[model samples]
Target: MEVKLHDIGEGMTEAEINCFLVKPGEAVKADDPLVEVQTDKMTAEIPAPRAGIIKEFTVQPGDTVSVGSTLLILEVGEQAGVPVKIEKNLPKPAVAELQAERLQSFAAVKRKRVLASPFTRKIARENGITIENVAGTGPAGRILDEDIYKFMAAAQQKPKLPAQPAPKEPAKRNDKVTSTIPLRGRRKQIAKKMVHSLNTIPHCTHFEEIDVTELITFRNELKDQNQTISATAFFLKALSICLKEFPVFNAELDEEKEAIHLLKDHHIGIAVDTEEGLIVPVIQNIEKKSIRDIHKEMKQLTDKALENMLTVKEITGGTFTISNVGPLGGSFGATPIIQHPQTALVSFHKTKKMPVVTEDDQIVIRSMMNISMSFDHRVADGATAVRFTNRFAELIQNPKMLVLEMV
Candidate 1:
């Protein structure tokens, strides 16, 4: 039996092998964990298809394979036969021609007038155009390779009704190649998601500085009592309270249905920096948890993320996200991009001992910090986002309010 890499969920097309759980000549049972592979989104354990002996491994650790590519060969239900051989990569022309022939045969079976080779059909499918609408210019009015390319080029060209600016000439560069790295695994996934978020979401960032002298004092008191709490826990608690008051901050925009969904559960995603990349692990029902509880859970989540042991559920379903750059040190504030589907993100920077004016107008030193808020402008206007950040700042500035609520 052959075990081919299949869909690993989240529309992932490829995966890199992290490690093989079973060795060659080892026997494995049906539904048993076989290979552990890592995609850009998450790490997954691929299970064996049937009970069999591991005959050969076609891929190795750090090697990336396509979605339908063979991962390994297994001996099941009979003597282990020779491993199935994979064919060579075909030339572009031959591949397109063969694809077109297959499409032509399918069109004939369906009794349709569409006369496209596989490549042409693929182009139409990718561009979301109907093949039947494309007029053929080849023999017998059949669609040719050139015909598909011409149609695509024509469709992509902008109209000449309005005068357009002259395009800039292409820049010349050194032809010698330096290095090439395969965009695979987590890095590739991050690139795709970041690009999509930037293109689709209109982001508005608001930066504000708050005097957290009292907040710092409160946290130090807790530490004196042998109860450790993280600044992230404080931020999460403040944001959760703010969300309760402003439901719009906790809402998700449904562009397809032209609606906004206000989520009741306060699942706050804490962005943790890992060696591979940044991953956000959500803490569910944050509104119901105390600062201590939030701190403990955040520590566990961070450890799991660093070790790459976080589950899929742990990494998803964040109503809002908080990215704390304080630990990195020497940073004041940063405008972070909104994690897609989520309307807002809050970034925390390092605390510094800066001079401040006292309530009585006396100059004094205080533990002040800067926080950056980023929101999807489509869902929230500048005023709304400002109000939300102001409210969050108010909560942080008044540390006594949080202490009273916890009591």
Candidate 2:
């Protein structure tokens, strides 16, 4: 049987082979994982169709294969008829050693049954740690990346013998040191999307400063009442309201049809920076969800993004995108690029206390934040973008007003 690569995600044309889990001539049960493949968005494992023996691999690690391309060949049932040779008589010592080796191999196979994600297993492999030895604290006893780190930390605490000093060798004059990173996975996908967005969209960014003093005080009051909510959650709610008023910013431009399609469902994507790359996971139906619900889902999605466990459905179908770079401390401003096909993106910067003049001409300290809103110039003009942001700022500055807008 020919085991082929299939489209794992929405319109995924190709994927890079990461590694093979089973070896040639190894016996595998039905639905056992055969190989790991890295798509542009996430990593996935291809499983065997039925109980079979691996015959040969059609593609090696790091090979890029397209949908319907042959990944490997499996010999099932009668097709796996290779004879096994058995010795009738042998020395007792050799026979005993053979039995022991088989037992060890059986134990190794049992260890491979541990539950873990592909990315988690990748961390274990890179650290040269046997995953079975690390105790899992995750649900269903699944091994997590943190478990491997804890194991390594425990091993480091063990005392070691001091090494003997050796004569130093002279440095070579011709040697030059440098490092290189292969841009083939998510990094490559990000680069391609960035280039396409820049080429196809006429981006116009507008910058503004928001007085968040009242919002901070309101949030603290809520916390005192044991109703803690993130500022971004409030921001998303305000943005949803603004999008309802200015639908042009929450739209897509179809050049071929010469039409502007305004989206009603407000699926907002939050840009999360991870170890792999910048990933945006969408929170669906922000117009219908409350601030508390948005906060809970945002935290859950951000956790999944950092662990590289977000699904295709969780990352797609976004009408707008936002980046909260305040925690990263870029306080001044940034020209955030809009997600391709999406009309606008907003980035909130760090908030700081500054002297401000009140309406009564009295000077007081106020918490202020900077925001950069970028929109497609072909879809919406500068004046509209300004109005959209002004409404968002108004809602944020007086967070209690958001309660009236809520369902």
Candidate 3:
């Protein structure tokens, strides 16, 4: 039986074969993981359909195969028919050619026995470096991505032929060699999305500063009660409320239908920065969830994202998006790119203590946080964006208002 690659989820068209878990002639029971494949989003293992001995692999590690492409052949009991004996009838020259071909195939297989993931191999291929030539420093002599980079750097530093005596002229600034990063995998995907968003949507960003002194105090009180909730949870709840009031920001423009479709459900996506790239995992139906529940779920999703273990469902169907770069220590503001098709995205920056003047002309220190909200100008105007954020600020400044709005 031929084992073919199938669509795992999210209409995946192609995937790179990471590695084979079982070797040729190895016996595997039903549902045993046969090979690992890496999609743009995550790495998954293709399992065996039934108990069978692995006959041969049609594809190799790091080879990108489309859906329905043959991955391997399996030899099930009795159905695999007996091997034909055609070699004995062949002429002398034909037999010699067949033997030589077998030897070459064996050598090729032996050379590819190095331990490495598909991503590591991709980096090596992009840099024109051979995986076998690079030394592995990982567990059980696995070739890591860093090893491939180190090999390239060392190769570049090798001494070349002696240069001719230079004149009094100095070298040009552009003559220096610089390292290049390969645009592949997740980074490539992000670039494509960003370009599409910029080209298709006219984005307008509005910046605001909110006094979070009372909110910080409220959080400290919660910590004393042994119930801790993140500030982002409160922000999400407040945003959901504002989205209900200003439905345009939570809508999608259907150019074909010449109308804007306002969504009733609030599925918010939190942008997480990982070593691979920015991954957003959705928190569905935020309007119905409490701040504590949102905080718990947000932590779980962020952990999964950092580990690159999020499923397709966890990353799709986002009505709105939020990026909290506060923990990363950027105190100012940034014009965050809106997730395509979603009307708006808000990014919260670092908070710091600043002086504030009260209504009674009293000066005091307060915790102030900056936020940048970017919305599709075609869908909503700047005034509407400002009003939406103003309501959000009001809810956040008074944490007690969130309790009355909770489900």
* Candidate 3 per-residue lDDT over residues 71-133, each given as its tens digit: 999866432222122357799888667656644543444332466654465566556576779
lDDT of 1 by residue, 26-126 (tens): 65566766777777667777787876667799999889888998889886643222122223697878766765654453333322335444334545555
- lDDT (Cα, tens digit) per residue for candidate 2, span 123-191: 776667766688988998988887877888898833221122244456568865443466765677788
- Which candidate wins on lDDT? 2
Error of 3 at 177 (Å): 3.2
TM-score of 2: 0.84
TM-score of each model, in listed order? 0.70, 0.84, 0.73
Better of 1 and 2 by lDDT: 2
User: Per model, how many backbone clashes are there?
Assistant: 4, 0, 0
Q: Could you give the C-alpha RMSD of every candidate to the true structure, in order shown?
A: 19.4, 6.8, 8.5
Q: On TM-score, who's better, 2 or 3?
A: 2
Top candidate, metric TM-score: 2
